[model samples]
Target chain A: MSEEVMTPETSQKVTKAPTKKVTKRDLFWAWLKWTTAVEVPVSFDRMQALAFSFSLNKILRKVYKDQPEELEAAMARHVQMFNTNCDWGSIIHGITISLEEQRAMGNEEVTPEIINSLKIGLMGPLAGIGDSVDQGIVATIPLAIFVPMALKGSILAAFIPGLIYIAWSYGWSWFLFNKGYSLGKSSVLSILHSGAIKKVIDIASIVGLYMIGCLSAAYVKFPIALQFKNSNSTVNVQKILDGMLPDLLPFALVLGMYFFIVKKGPHYLGIIIATMVLAIALTFLGIM
Target chain B: MLFKAFLVGIIYWLSMGRTAYFVSFAFRKPVVLGVFIGLVFGDVQKGLLYGATIQLLYMGGIEAGGNIPSDQGLAACIAIPAALMSNLNPSAAVALAVPFGVLGVMLNNVRRTFNSFYTTYSDKLVKEHKYRTLSYFSFLIPWATNFVLYFTPVFVATYFGSGLVKAFINAIPTWAMDGLANAGNMLPALGFALTLVVMGKKQYIPFFALGFYMYAVMGFSMLTGAVFAVCFAMISSLFKQHDDDEEDYA
Candidate 1:
């Protein structure tokens, strides 16, 4: 994993004609195009698909590097490269390269590469955190709040989340990308050795775990019930559990689902269908 | 009124139909299409609000291992608009969306079928060197057209369907009205509870109790409580590093 990054020696040389007098309009279109490209899913192995957009950026630099008048266009072209090449890979990598590339004009070339490794090490764990925060925490909480509020006729209610998330989602992406890149561009190697990445991963994991707990409560939708009526008494077993707490039955259900998945090796996609069918079938037999 | 519903459906299909799920998959984030619906129905704020609320209702709704969650996109787009358009209570709006969410699963299957054809055609196109045609058909044009086909029906139906539903409810006998009303009020909580059970993990029972107590006993909404609990857990987690690191030692 610490092997040196592929460098300028092998940088794919662009032969496309110079971006013909690229303008502000070209910049917008460039951003839009790359953002859309980045939208496509890539093979898990390499967010290498980002290479396509980054390559486009390189081509832009080649064409516009000499034209100081086109510098802003080139910069927009760079950020727009993200939009088209916009996977987590590109976002993270672009920032790393942006930092390294900036520093490279007068500094060590290897600095960017070393900076990327520690940053790269952080990516998977960050993915865990990013996925949890963006997909789980930020999304679900606002959504749960938004639904009821909208039900109540508050128009401003929805935008509250948008404002919050646009900031969080875009902010985190931009922050981490730029932060990772800037750090990578500098000392590059010591960042990881500093224990900062470890601390970051540790914090993210803890948050992710708590989210799993919240996710358990928020997402799972079952409760246990054992109803018994003697000559003079009645009980809901679920009520007893509920009295103990909200998620006992839920925890049990998840355990059951997890075991079923783990032990049975249930195919992930088909498991829901199979379980739903089994539940329905059991209900038909008056067993569920 | 029916046309309005149909129009809404068309619009939703256009925006979300062709590639929303995949688009979201790209970002690994749900589209929050509810915000879009809220805006369209002259209640962007309300729509977004409702969307977030339901987001919790399906937090574990992932497509991991091919598991299709209740189609949240369809739920937000259709159910939310139905709520606004029908004058049905928002609770009723949510109630209406549940069944339709299940229907969305069926629609998603239909989409998969189309993709299969697209895939097969790609092979044939490759064999014949029909690169331009294959790429165009495989990726772009089909989704563009299907967007119209999928969204139009939904908008149209919401306008008409909610009206029809309103009519159907009015036409229902008084005796059934109480039952329906009671069911509407109880079902979501039931659904929420059921969902909690569906996605549970061992040793996480207490949090559920906290959630249940917040909603059932303390009169706090689950969202507020969940947020509180999550934050508390986060803070505790920050402080509990000794414990986690100790576990790492184990």
Candidate 2:
């Protein structure tokens, strides 16, 4: 299967001027359908497959307008198991659309196998990179910066993080969608392998880590209620701890949870239940 | 009150319904939902406070591969109104949000399971070459299904559950309430800690320490923290680039 893909005949196709053209309007509608419907029909088995076919249904019909048999085959092909990070995976849609157009325009090298392989190949990496960069950095850091302001009674601040996220996702997804259409398969590999993206991820990690710290300090509360009673005076444990490190308990709590996740591997429900039980028990014992 | 519950139900559906996925994703944040939910309850300030507090517990709620770790939207929608109606403190409101957030993941699973029917339907449509009908089934039908799945519980909870929530709060001893609030405060750690795990770079743990201790000592605004963070990241990246250049030279 791998050798078939690598065979010289199937490697690259020469560009031909004669074509069934997909106009900008057609692509826009396709993208619109994609963005809106991508997750709507998501299932346990096929995932976004129905939505994937739904988005391409019109485009497929138009491209294979002269070939009804081909159009039906195309429809059947798309509604197979499909899932990926929505915005980042727009590139896959772009690539698929362009490839279908080429195949419709008589590019024999653009086989069904090649298209399916490309989608399968690209989705995982893009999903991994997209989820972390988009959700971990873009969606989160803004919330860290703005939610405090929202807490302080600023209505605009409440919407700003979300606004930034919406803008970034739409803008980036649309740009990538077009980039995929024009550049086809080669561009994604280049973009993925590029040092620029790595640098971006590195910087995002630093900024994200730092912001998580700031947020942790600002948010996580673990105040100790223990006190040392003496003949002369009572020493407040919380105040003494505050005097040494203002949010020491919170810091330790965050570290404890982080290490738990690292060791136990993200069993969040267990962690949450344990934390609740522990807090309630400590409160019962007058320890926190 | 019924009208408000209905509107809040719509908000939940809009946010979690997966329609216009990115826009819905933004709208679903507790802070954002707080604003809308506040409008329904006629107390934007109180709603924002409760919502923002709840938001902290979900700050790092990354829905990687479309599997939400918790449903912050459901948590906020259900808990905020109950908190407002009962006048629960923000910390206690956060505690109220947690169980609802966990419950929401179950609804998501059910919705996904229910949607499996569409796959078989879509396969038939393609075989029959009924593309138009397939498109409707793909988006609109599934979305309507989600409206039922996402909206009903929220509406029922908001309209009927608030009274129960208030009574439940009243029945609980003050010590238990205080403990719940304390738990609320500590729960934000889970979000941040989860984020640390997701960020997945052990070497950068120092930056987190720097940010935490810096904030602990200086206590500057988040924007100021961001500026400092960016600068630190840039300077470190510059050193990294220099090392890369030397490696190229070697």
Candidate 3:
């Protein structure tokens, strides 16, 4: 099953254009426009359709300069409801650009249906993987490391994480963008199915999980301020708990929340409100 | 004070505006925003401290599918400035940030709803072949709409709401204040736990347990923890590769 999925036939059927109209500068401008304005024109009806079309507007016009009817159709097609993870979704744009370029250069095989289906099919999986890797690891682990330093009055520490995120996003997205453009759609499938990407994701997951664990231990704070009073002496319940395990309450608190999420789905507002109310109630009862 | 508030509003717009999303994403984190907000208030260290404290609540704030769990940028932009003006403690500042974070989500929805207008307008431009004007409608005009949606509340809150927050904080009793602070501390767990769920690898949970206990036992710096994490991951993957190789041979 794995082998079948991994090995797609590597056949390059599309004939190369004798002289390409779409230049390197055109591709660069398309990428720049896509990256900058992808999220700006987002709406409820069509999340990123306008921005996606905006990125390709000039390029589509350039590609089909003589064929105004085709250009109009292409423009109309791109301005449909399109949404995905911003950086990882660049590959979709690259593929779209290439397919459009080919169709303009008169590749009859690259149908409009093919272009739309490829985009719709690819966006969800890429988004699922991209959101986890980008936000879960690249954006987060740095915060886990540097936030403590920022607390200790290091301003540079605060900026470093953001810088790391920016660099990774731009660098990786641009790389994928170029790859998608050069490799075209079929190679993208093979690349997605490859074991190397899977291994990379696995490694990243472990690292991300480990860092989150450390972050939870260091940051999540719940203490048992409760105590037992006797006539002769007073017993500190928190101290007794601490003797058994340092940060026991905090650990339990984090796990309890985790299980709550697991069982009840992500109704975060309720959880937050419940936590605040419970904390306040516990404080009132002198048990927190 | 008006000028400072206006500057803060602009910062909020820039961070939440989603213009050059990569840059804005980096700009929006409370810790980063803390420095800028602090600069406006003339105390970088305090701002950093406040921003970092509030940031803990949102460490795992993953906005998957363009749906934000909470608006951390809005939280920081409002709370940091108010905390700066009113001399609120770090934990209290965190407590203050939570509500605003929630509020920011509504504003985001509103911005999205407002942007629907542009979609129809773009269709009109495309029909008429006014391609040049369509480009403006796609980016600049929608961005300008966001400036109004994102910037005003922050400006008003900073300029007018700071005094109100100070008054409200003063009115609240000491016990409740302590409770709020305690709640603030506990809230960070939500972020971490949410990340765990999103990671969606139930089998790798042992790694999380290992990391948590390891940190609890020997409180290392985050950088040190990362080094250990990378090594552990690499070693584990190496073992997995061996297993895969054996399977392939079979």
lDDT per residue (tens digit) for residues B112-175 in model 2: 9999998888889988988899988999999999999999999999889888998887888877
Which candidate order results from sorting by DockQ in descending order? 2, 3, 1
Range of the 10 consecutive residues with the lowest summed lDDT in candidate 3 chain B: B241-250
Please give the RMSD of candidate 3 to the true structure.
Answer: 5.6
State model 2's lDDT: 0.85
* Proportion of native contacts present in model 2: 0.81
lDDT per residue (tens digit) for residues A1-288 in model 1: 122353664322221222233333433343333334332222222232232333344334544355443433333322221111122333455344444344323234544345445345544433443443444445455655554565465655544554565556544554444454445444433553345544543443333334444445444545333377899999877677767865565555555655555466534334434444544443344332
What lDDT would each prediction earn against the true structure?
0.45, 0.85, 0.85
Clashing pairs in 2: none
Tens digit of lDDT per residue, candidate 2, span A1-288? Answer: 011233344343312222357888888898989999988899999889988888888889888877888899999999999988888889999999999987986778899999999898888767766776788788988888788799899999999998899899999999988888988887777876678877877788888889889888887889899888999999998999888878888999998989988897867777777887888888988889
TM-score per candidate: 0.59, 0.88, 0.89
Candidate 1: residue A116 Cα off by (Å): 14
Fnat of all models, as shown: 0.06, 0.81, 0.76
Candidates by TM-score, descending order: 3, 2, 1
What is the TM-score (0 to 1) of candidate 3?
0.89
TM-score of 2: 0.88
* Candidate topping TM-score: 3
